[model samples]
Target: MTTTSEHTQSVATATPSRMLRYLPASALLIDAALMTLVGLVAIVGRRELDVFASSAQVEDQLVLAGPLMIVGWIATVALLGGYRRDVFGVGTDEYRRVLNASLLAAGVTGVVCYLARFDLSRGFFLLAYGLGVPSLILGRMALRRALHSARRRGLLRHRVLIAGSRAHIDEIARVLGREPWLGYEVIGALTPEYDLSEETATGVPVVGNADEATSLAKAYNADSIFFAGGAVGSSSQFRRAIWELEHESIQVVIAPSVTDISNERINIRPVGGLPLMHIEPPTWSDASRWGKRLFDLAGSLFLVLVFSPLFAFAALSVKLHDRGPVLFRQERIGKDGGRFACLKFRTMVVDAEARLNSLHEASGHSEGLFKMKDDPRITVPGRWLRRFSIDELPQLFNVVRGDMSLVGPRPPLLREVESYDVDTTRRLHVRPGMTGLWQVSGRSDLTWDEAIRLDLYYVDNWSMLQDISILTKTLGAVVSSRGAY
Candidate 1:
């Protein structure tokens, strides 16, 4: 006979509140309505151009298209997990899924139109696709901001229970603290060996042990239980805790030991009855090197061509403002401790280096790196240029010169490298990047440890996809202008 614990129900399994149920439905309705409106507008816009004129444009065909588009919108949302309650106010994942669904829907519509021999205007379809993608993402972003406002106002919040030792639970608490927009308030924690003196991490009460955790959850009405990485005594202890909590209908989230692992590198497979994790390291070989180099060269050339006007404008502005050289070249440590001339549009006074000696004490010495948050030597135009990263555009020339890759760790100053311990020296293994993990994340706001961790993580998990992601994020980072001196 199966034990009572083994036959128990799931936690957070209770029916969602009426408000919770309605919110997602409301979001889906809004999504569908926006898609239909955008699609109709696109169709009208296309018909104005001669490329979309057809015989059916008079009346009957126009009337029939509305219902078909609505149906398509609904189907797209369903396929894309739009109405899913969980992802409603979450991160970009929900929006990404919706965008993918729209693309798929557009593809299917194309195929069906082709198969049915219906004369659909290609221009109209393209307009709809173009509008639908941005509309979906923008709509979601707007909704997310609204939902975040509601959460801050204390309206739609999730009460959570965390399980594990103090150290593990503390990590979970800090993560939750960083994502208050997610609206998860820790109700309590469950630990096998409870210590009252150190009972709570992040001020959430330590309620009970594994056996009594279910009652504590019920009392707190927690939406879910987060299992932080820790031993659960025995297999039976783990099984028993899960069984007891299941009857209360709670969703259980097991936090794995893995952190800072790139999404591209991890794949899960089922082996017999157990789940196996497969981690494929980033491709870094002779062929990969060649491909990456080729990609960097081609992309740098394309960007240089496209942004030629902006580049010229920046150079002109610098020249007009100051009587010095437009380009700034510094000897910085590159890959494998090689020194390269890192180029930038000069943003500081020519005497900036000369004045550095007087300001050296102002730049604090921490981990052998000195940083001056407010250097007096920065020229007026230089301040604005550095803030928006306009000064860094000239790095494209460095990429062309084979001295730098488009993406990698930030180049360390020669003085900075001299101060590195054995571990920090690992960053020199790869070519220094124009913008990187730390630059996109926090830049100067990051402490030395966090900065090193980001660099090490990049070195450990570097990939073409990851590089692309960093480059994309760098665009936003430049716009935000955070942590720039």
Candidate 2:
């Protein structure tokens, strides 16, 4: 019933919306405002607020210098690519640039003051930067949160055209699909010249052949083009394709066949005209060392102390609900096949474990994962506890005892561990976590295989930064309760 012209128009309209133009302008305005506010706060803290008055006869030269510093700081951020559209969302590159810019601006200001004999207050300088840098980073984080929320609602996503073999195209598409916050919307696939198909195995629509990547990309009004593995036969052809797309505003991303590798593990090197990808070996060994353990212990200790009141309340609630035990302890497999008693606030009836087999048989997935939504066994208070993950708070004790980490693979039950394949067994390299990639990703909503995949990926690519990021994302995930019981 639909004509080709109407279809084409609808498809083309999938390109970026007004958010494409608003994001950069918003970042600039926010940065300027934040820096100005920090400068004012610094001035007031140092009792140099009089510098703003025209009649103030201050020898500190704070009047002209303060405004110049704020302006220069903002300019420095823009000069260092902080305002670029590419760094606007989804990574720490923007925050890192802002930090670098702040440092550069401060150094220049110090140098200029010394060379010109301008009396700049040292206290004000330290106070301003110390507050300003963090404030700017927080501002960017808040803006990024807004961008992520919009993308999750299917707004402002990049229209990505993937050019590759079917298998590689699907792989890239899967990753992009999993992380909606990354905002890559796959418009269609550009297959290798040999095979012409209407769609991929995963049902991603096929638009054209690989050789016509540039043309098809433009036709779709793609915001980005991903050249997945096998898009071209040789280096020269790849180079030609890149050159063809240079005139368009479309971003070109080369997606290697590899999956589940973090950016930290991948290093691109220029080797005699070729970009050689160097992959660092897994960080699991290093992560299992004392540094991470020390952090886990201290962090858990702090959490336990701070949440003592909440802990008491949870315990009391469990006790009052049906007079059941306050704590539920289950033996779980931990690092390198070791067993530990994982703890949680009791959120189910006393005989809940006895009902598992029947539920499993009824659900038909009787072997690997055992989850039942609206589970009748969960107490009324238990539902609320599970929804917000207050039940998992007792895992801090497991962390204290060194059986778990603040961030690592999910702790598996004895039965679950029995079924793990060789690849999945690698998750034992580090201790299990109170919260992990699996916990924050989808929790009970994830497929058994998907949960294992995320756990294995965490085991093989562990880093303190990755751990910290997962921990931060965990807060948002808990607040949203995306995939809780």
| Per-residue C-alpha lDDT of model 2 across residues 360-439, encoded as one tens digit per residue | 77878656657788999999889999999999999999999999999988888889889878888898888999889988
How do the residues 14-63 of candidate 1 rate in per-residue lDDT, one tens digit apiece?
43223555777777777787877877777777767657556655224446
Q: Whole-model Cα lDDT per candidate? A: 0.75, 0.86
Model 1: ten consecutive residues of lowest lDDT: 3-12
TM-score of 2: 0.90
Q: Which stretches of candidate 1 lie over 4 Å from their true place?
A: 1-23, 50-65, 89-134, 141-157, 179-184, 194-197, 200-205, 247-249, 282-288, 302-329, 345-364, 418-423
* Backbone clash pairs in model 2 (N, Cα, C under 3 Å; residues 3+ apart or in different chains), count: 0
